[model samples]
Target: MTKPVIVVPKGMEFIRDEIGYAPAVLANGTLYIAGQIGRDDSRQLVTDKEAQFVQVFENMKRVLAKAGGDFDNLVEMTSYHTDMRDLPLFMQVRDRYMKGVLVAWTAIGAAQLCGAPGYFLEVKAVARID
Candidate 1:
């Protein structure tokens, strides 16, 4: 018997000082992406809730693309938000990015995040690939 191999894509960062995990991985046509906060490519946190939400979705899309996936392939999206009141803001930004592409969504409230000024959110997504 042979072990099934997992083909994790490249360009995902390995930040040992941070959470000590790769940003994303691909195995058996499924891509598991790490939680993406409201940050840009440089990893700088986006402060504004509305802007940060958009940035977070954009970051997720980029990682999915690197894994040979897209928004249409996304099956689940999990959001952890520091402020429960920001749910509307999150949706407002999500609507702009989703463009009618529906997927399973779960939103949870948390006390705080890993970033300063309490970065609003961290998103984890599971996407299917061709």
Candidate 2:
């Protein structure tokens, strides 16, 4: 008899609790990662534009690493910003982390985010694993 099992890794406290979602699910040889915000390891939001952008990617990286994925494995990204004026700095920081892989990306602007003042950026990513 063959029974399918659901596998969720550890160190994903946010997904299991705060976020109430799985970080990644491996099925049929693919890993689907959920959207990630600019919150740090402590789940505290980084409000500054540049700071938030960096934290956004860092947060994503931590989750991805937990799921055995990495930036090179990423195929797509979606970014949300409270202000479009910060686009340049966002791009600058994004490129630094991306290493010029030029993966698919979508950047959008919003009036606000669910946190303290000055939370200018939010990012989510999708990565593939064989």
Candidate 3:
């Protein structure tokens, strides 16, 4: 069996070294992306919920791109939100990026995340490339 390849998109140095986790790992035609939050290049959390939601998707897209896949390749996703009340907004942002891509998803409410302060949501995804 081939070894898993850790995918580290450009400009994700902190996530690779400081955070000690690969943004995604590719193996056996599948890519597993880690939970992505709304932090910008500087690693500062965005304050707006809508912005955060968009950033999460954008971050996932970056990982997918690094793995030679796209949104259409995504098969499943799981999201953790600090507030379930933001579901409608989350869905709206999701649709903006997902468009015609069909993916199974699950969302759960959580009291907090690893980095709380301004962070509200985290999204993890799985993609099949073959």
lDDT of 2 by residue, 34-63 (tens): 655676666677656578788877767766
Q: In terms of lDDT, which candidate is strongest?
A: 3
The lDDT of model 3 is 0.91
- Kindly indicate the candidate among 1 and 3 with the higher TM-score: 3
Q: In terms of TM-score, which candidate is stronger, 1 or 2?
A: 1
Model number with the top TM-score: 3
TM-score of candidate 1 relative to the true fold: 0.83
Compose the digit string of candidate 1's lDDT tens values, residues 1-130. 3332333334335442354766676777777777887776666777777888888888887787776677888888999998889888888888877778888899998888874665889899888887
Using lDDT as the measure, what is the rank order of every candidate, best first? Answer: 3, 1, 2
- Model 3 ranges with Cα > 4 A deviation: none
lDDT per residue for candidate 3 within 27-46, as digits (tens), equals: 99999999999988787788
The residue pairs found clashing in candidate 3 are: none
TM-score of each: 0.83, 0.79, 0.96
Worst 10 residues of 2 by lDDT: 1-10
